[model samples]
Target: SLFRILGELWPIFGGNVSKPKLTDMFYIPQKPYLTVGTLRDQVIYPQTREEYDELHDSDAGLAELFALVRCSNIVEREGGWDAVNDWIEVLSGGEKQQIAMARLIYHKPKYAIMDECTSAISIDLEGFMYVHCKKIGINLITVSHRPSLWMYHEYLLKFDGRGGWEFGPMVLPEGYQQGTA
Candidate 1:
C-alpha cells in the first residue's frame, strides 16, 4: 500500500523536485516525506534548490550547529557546505545522527518523537541535544532504553508488549548521578 501511494504521488517527487514545472505536481495539502541527503539539505529540508536560494545566496550557520554537535570538522575538511557528496557514504553513524539532531533543532518543532535517533551519538552529546531541545521549548517523546535519558522527560510510559502499559511521572534510575558543573 505504501509503495502504491508513493507511486501515485510520484509526480510531486518525480524527477528533480527543483524543476518549477513540477510545482503543480498534485497538491497534498500537508507535509509529505522529505529526504535528508546532504548537509545543507538536512538543514533546509523539503526546500528545493530555488527555495533554498531564495533564503541564501550565501551559506548558513551549519558550522555553528556542527560545533554544537561536537562534529565541526566537516566544513573545513570538505571545503564548505557547497562541497556536496554522498554524506551517507562519507559520514560515520554518529556523525549522521548528529546531523539529524541539528536538523531537528533547526526546525524547532513543538513536539518530536525520537525513536533511537540517538543510538549512535555519544552520551554527552545526546544529553546536550536533550538540554538544547528543552531550552528551545520543544517537547520530546523519545524512544530509548538509555536509563540516563529518563531525567529529561516529565513522564515515563512503558509498554508491557501486551495490551498493557504504564505511564506516570519521571523516575530516575538507581545510581544516577547528576554531573556537577
Candidate 2:
C-alpha cells in the first residue's frame, strides 16, 4: 500500500517532466486493481484527491507533485493543500532540499547527478534515499564530502586539493590515508 502511494506521489514529490510511460518504469506485479488514483486517495486526503488525480493526467503535474511531497507535512499542519501557493515559500532549507529531490525523482532521468544534494538531510535519510535510487536502477553520480556517503557509490573520485585528482574503484583503507602534498 505504501509503495503504491509512493509511486503515485513520487512524480509529484520529485517534480518529474519526462513523461512516464508504463513501459519505462516497472511496477510490482500483484493486485491489478491499484491505479494511480487509488494510490493517491490512500496516502493523501479525500478533499485533495481531485487535485492529486489531476496531476497524474498532465505534464505540469510533475512540478505540482514535487511541491506537494516537499511541503505536505507543513501544509497539512496549516490545513492547506495547494503545493504552488504561499506554503512553498516558507519551507525550511531541508524541506526545500527534499522538494528538489522529489522533483528529480519525478523526472525519472536516465542519469542523475547529485551535487551535494543531501547536505541538509540527516545521514540516515540520505542513506534511505540512496537505497531507493539503487533499487530503481537510476544511475547516480553523487558528490558529497561525507565519508559515509561513499558507501553508496561504486567508485570514488578524490581531489587532493592541490591541483591533483584521483578516480578509481573505492577501497576501504585500513587506517586513515593522509599525506601532505
Candidate 3:
C-alpha cells in the first residue's frame, strides 16, 4: 500500500523508480498508510481507529505529541485534542511538516526515507525530528542539500551532476565537521 503511495508521490520530486516489493526492501513497512480520519489520526496515521483504540490511545499522549511537535497551540485553540476538523485547510506548510514528523516519530519505523520532509519546518523542529529518529534507532535516509543538515550524517554522497558522485566521510566547512560542530 505504501509502495503504491511511493509510486504516486515519488514522481512529483524524485527520479524514476520501479515497482517496489516487500521482499526487495530492507525493512518491513509498518507505518500505517496515510488516511483522513480524526485529528488524532493525522498524527498517528496509517493506524485505523480500531487499532488506535486497541492500542489505548489517550488525549494526554496526544497532547504530549502535539507539544513535542510545537503545535499544541492548535489543539488548545481548537478547544481540545478531540476537535476534529480539516487540518489541511487550517495548517500552514510548516505545521503540516511538523505533523508529519510527529507521525513519523509515533510510527518509529526501522527505516525511513525522509525526502526533504523537513524542508518546510524550522531548524529547531527539524533538529528535534533528527534527534527523535536517533533516539528510536530509525535508519534515516535524508535527501537534502541543505548545509545545516550535513552535521547529522557520518558519510556524505555528493553528486557532480555529470553522472559523477563522491561518497566518503563528511567534509564540511570549519567548525561544522562531524563531532566538532
Candidate 4:
C-alpha cells in the first residue's frame, strides 16, 4: 500500500528508503504517538530549542496554532499545553491526528505523507483540515482507501501491492468538483 510507496520514496526525498526527512515533513502512520516530546515540542519541531523558547514565551502563537487545528480546548482539557506527558494516552486517536495536523499547519511544510492517520476523525473535520492545509499551501500525500478524501487531493499515486504503481491526476465523480466536499 501507501507505506510501500513511502518506503521507496523516502530516500529520494531525504533519508534512507524507510524514513523521510523528519525535520521538515510530517509523517503520520495509522498509529501516532506523543512520546516524541511534549505538545509544544511536537508542533515546534525543526525549530531550535531557542526558537521554541521564543514561541513558548510569546504563548499566543502556540495557542493560535492549536486553535487552527480545533484543539485549543484540549490543551486546557488535558491539564495544559506544556504539561501533557503522554498525549497518546490522554487523547483519543482522532485527537492524536489533530495534533499531528496542528504540527503540519504550524510548520507549513511543502509536503506531508500520511498513512491512514486520520482514520478516527469525522469526515467533516477531516475535510476541514484538508481545506485548511491546502489554504496554507501544504501539499498532502495521503495514503488511504477512503474515497471520501479524494475531493481534497489533485493527484493519485496508486501502488498495486505487487511491486507496481501508477501516478496521475485524480478522477472525480461526474459533476463533482475538487474541494467542493
TM-score per prediction, in order, is 0.73, 0.55, 0.74, 0.79
**Per-residue C-alpha lDDT of model 4 across residues 1-181, encoded as one tens digit per residue:** 4454553433354434544554446666777646645667666655666877755666687788787777788878766656747666777787888887887787887778878978988777888888888888887888898777998888888778887989999998797544434
lDDT (CA) per prediction: 0.65, 0.52, 0.65, 0.73
Candidate 2 collision pairs: 12-65, 12-66, 13-102, 14-102, 14-103, 15-103, 16-106, 16-107
Worst window of 10 by summed lDDT in candidate 3: 23-32
lDDT of 1 by residue, 1-181 (tens): 1222322443443443332222222211112222435557755665665787876666646667778877788778766676677776777777777777776776666666666678887677788888998898877776678766777888987888876889899877678875421
Tens-digit lDDT track of model 2 for 60-148 = 44435544444456445534433333323455556656655554565455555566677876776667666666766776666667665
TM-score of 4: 0.79
Off by over 4 Å in 3: 1-36, 175-181
**Winner by lDDT:** 4
Q: Candidate 4: deviation at residue 10, Å?
A: 7.7
Residue 130 Cα positional deviation in candidate 4, in Å, after optimal superposition? 0.6
Cα distance off (Å), candidate 3, residue 61: 1.9
Deviation of model 1 at 37, angstroms: 5.3
Task: Give each prediction's root-mean-square deviation over alpha carbons.
Answer: 9.3, 13.6, 5.7, 4.1
Better of 2 and 4 by lDDT: 4
How badly does each model clash, as a count of residue pairs? Answer: 0, 8, 2, 0
Model 4 pairs whose backbones collide: none
lDDT of 4: 0.73
